[model samples]
Target: MSAQIKNGTILLAEPFMLDPNFKRSTVLVVEHNPEGSLGFIMNRRVNMRVDALAKEFPEFDAPVYFGGPVGTDTVHYLHRKGDLLEGSDEVMEGIFWGGNYEKLRFLIDQKLITPYDIRFFVGYSGWSDSQLQEELEGGSWVTARMDPNYLFKSDPEKLWSQVMENKGDTFSVIASMREEPSYN
Candidate 1:
């Protein structure tokens, strides 16, 4: 791949993408290798909270996000807890994803990890070998350096446009386009 697509790369969906699953989605790539790639949609928060989906989870007001279309029945998480959560893989300088689940609960119960330290998701995006490369070549996604603030702080509804505008130039122009412009 000509582009340095790697862990922590943020894949911004092209403005007029038609795929309902990822239209205007901002995906944070957590794993990318020869076999395939895995990531979570960072901006597509579902209308449900995490505790509503799991009684075992510690009491927290955080919402559960729609990570992607695949593995909708499963759960995943991204965090800034680092080694504090055993087995958590560092996706970049500061972000981590997944780890020993039971240990995570233990840390949460101990008041070591707060809602701001982690974000949960119901599923994740996946790409087969060469699939993502093909999509990148086709312009379905605009790759950007993953920014933690975009994932942790930006308003979910404004994330796609915010990231696009931050790109500053062609991307900003694209960000300003109407979601559905009539040509007739």
Candidate 2:
């Protein structure tokens, strides 16, 4: 992987990826190290809401996303509320990952956290040490700089193409290709 591909970087799965878990997905790398890499797929929304998945969670209407194929029973979150949410690790200048869950509920109950301010995930994408680097070298993924807006303001259905186009150059062309080639 390029040196620039690290924490807070965005990983766009190559346009033609065949893996059911990641095909056409855009992922946000929240942690990267020599040990391993951890991220959430930014574009795969689940058909359920936060309250529907967790009985203890406050009755907020935030849609949950299919984070990845690993640890599917766990819950995670990314948000723009670092300033007000305690224990939030800054993934980038304005984005945060994982914070106090009780506090999160309180904030939601208090009407302080809007659905637009946060995203919930049911699992994460992980790569063993050097695994992601190998994938990059093999053309399974492409890197893009993370924009806070991509998480909070963009539509999940269009995030992959949106980020690809924003990457410019050849990537912009890649963004326009059909998800699956016609083969005609």
The per-prediction tally of clashing pairs is 0, 0
Worst 10 residues of 1 by lDDT: 175-184
Q: Write down the RMSD of candidate 2 (Cα, Å).
A: 1.3
- Deviating ranges (above 4 Å) for candidate 2: 1-3
Angstrom error at residue 105, model 1: 1.5
Report the lDDT tens digits of candidate 1 across residue range 1-184: 4567899999999888999999999999999999999999988888887777876977777888899999999999999988798888999988999898888888888989888888899988999999999999988999988788887888888998898899898988888887886731
Residues 1-184, candidate 2: write the lDDT tens digits: 4545778999999988999999999999999988999999999999999999987988898999999999999999999998888999998898999899889999999999999999999999999999998898998999889998999899999999999999899988999898768941
**lDDT, model 2:** 0.92
Best prediction by lDDT: 2
Indicate the residue-level lDDT of 70 in model 2: 92
Cα lDDT of candidate 1 equals: 0.89
